[model samples]
Target: MKRKLLFGERMLLGDGTEAFNAVIPFRLRGIFKEEDIQHALGQIQAKHPWLRAIITHDENNIPWFEVPGNHLPIPIRTVMRKGENDWQEESAKEWQTLFNYEEKPLIRFIWIKGEELSDMLFVFHHCLCDGGSAMAFLYEFLQILDHPSAEIGVESPILGIQDVVPAEILNNRRQKLKAKFIGRLAATAIKCIPVSKKAIERKNDYLIHWKFDKETSSELISYCKSQEVTVNTFLSAAVLHAFKKVRGNAAFNKVSCPVDIRRFAPQIKDDHIFAFGLMIVVSANYKINFAENLYAMQEAVERKTAKLNPYITMMVMESAHDALKNFTKLLKHGKSSNDCMFSNLGRIQIPHQYKEFTLDTIFSPSVIGPLGNTTTLVTSTFRGEMDFSFMGSEGYLPYSEALAIRDEVIETVKLQLDPIAVL
Candidate 1:
């Protein structure tokens, strides 16, 4: 089966020259055979059609995800693990490596071979999957890796826009007209907006990672509960506070958070490999202190989330196909308006231990692309500990400045939880 790329997928695919990659790194403490690893991946490939599909261009130059008859299995690249930081280094390198979209599947596996502790990086093109999908695959991979006979059901893939947007919305004539009109209007306005002829330079990209111990993580959760705010909101506030503290007036007041589309649309399954996502932009109210800002941000987040219309948003984007190039160009050349794209996957439900092996850690996934504002921070809790992956480029955000921001982010969160715990 095959289908044309969606608007978001088209933008991410670009010309397929540069990599827009997402790396999900985790460590396993046990003996693993290459045959078992490949078999597990093979089962995952069989369950999801996208896992084995390749990108092909049509006469109109539109990209399509097509399953080639006798398509090659997902490729694996294995290397010896030198230290704990090996996965981080390899993740950075993978971000710069382009996918052979026409010849192979969009996903690849990297096994960091070690005598007892093996760190694996499940790397894939951002156009092919999202954080939720990544986590789902990891859970399934771990299950089948331990029990090869595990019965994870197959996925009925979303082949077209129809599968994403509800049929009622697409069938209504009034909705169709509204979507077309708004899409065209937005496209025209985008074309008229002035942008820099040259894109912003983002040189020497890097990822800085850290984790909060289970005790500290639990304490922070309890603290958020007492404040009547979510751990996500509090963390957002702390992260923004750090940017302001480290970058001073140079930092943007805004942070963009991606909301999972599956929450809004039930047609999109948790296991389906899809990339579309809704977003909410947030900023602290400077007139209020950090404590007051948490409540304000929480309210704002809820109000915005409640108002989101995923069906309408999908309809509009689907109608805006002609403006794909201009929209992508605007993003690539647009002025930086936000400090960074931050996402909190919340707590991961995947089990950390199997009968054969122990799951050590699931590092927060990192994704980078050629689009505007390559800087991003992602957080997720696994095994009762919260982990973070902060990614940025030297030209956009210097490594020294990123280091300062990292330290400040941790300090700001600690100060909010407990001053005595600050270290």
Candidate 2:
């Protein structure tokens, strides 16, 4: 069986010159045998068909995921653990390691073997899955490892655009013409515009991670509830403020937040391993107080979300496949407009307890691509504590500035919880 790649997936694959890797590091306190991991991976592969699929290009150079008569298993590499932060260094290295798309699956594993504790990094081609889908796979892997008899159901993923966009919408001639016209116009415009001969150099990428204690995390949650806004909104506000303070007047007030398309498109199940992205850009008013700025950002988020039409976006992208190269060029050569991309997976509901091993901590996943800007912050809370993974290139954001921004972000959140500080 073969299926065409989605717009976002195609963009991620790029020209096959660079790797677009997404890695999630899981910290486990107890022993996890290699055999058990292999068994769990086998089970996961059997359940998800895409796990066994390889990428092949058509005569037109478009990428397609094809499952031939025989498929290869996902590669598993074991490394000796030198220290606690060894996984971080390895993950960074994996960002540049390109996958042999024709011969193997787009996902792989790196296990850091330690005496007492271990870290497992789940690395996937960004075209294969998003953070939500990756988290689902992680949960299932742990479940199967803990209990061999556990029943992790199979997934029925959308195979093509027809599966997502309704027949009525696709069948409408006017809608089809409109999409085609828009696509052609975009392609022509992109060709007419002059692009930079030398793309921005993205070097010295680094990830800084930290977590808030349970009490502090709980207090922050309570404060968000009292203020009638989500923890995500508050965090977005803090991120904007921190960037402005650390990067000085050069920082962009705008921040891009990715919204899970699954929310708007009910047809796409939670377990589906799709990679298309729907994002809303939010900006803060630095002229106002922090609390007021947060509320304003929250309102803006609500307005943008309410207006989002995933179906139209999907159709438009499907018609614009020819513009993929132009989009990639713009991404690589464009100047950084937004300060950073912020994504909060919110509270992770995955079970931390296993029959044999217990999960110690779930670090926020960090991903960096060859795309121009490397500034990104990913947050996820597990077992009532919030964890953050901040990644950026030294060329784009100085290491010293990133450290200051990280500290300011934490303090900004804490300041909201402190009544004296608010006063």
Write the residue-wise lDDT of candidate 2 on 264-339 in tens digits: 9888777788888799998988788988987888899999999997877888888888788787888888778899
What lDDT does candidate 1 reach at residue 107?
96
Weakest ten-residue segment in model 1 by summed lDDT: 414-423
Highest lDDT model number: 1
Off by over 4 Å in 2: 192-194, 420-423
- Each prediction's TM-score versus the true structure: 0.98, 0.96
TM-score of 2: 0.96
Error of 1 at 235 (Å): 0.9
Residue 386 in candidate 2 has what lDDT?
Answer: 95
RMSD of 2: 1.7
- CA lDDT of each prediction against the hidden true structure: 0.92, 0.87
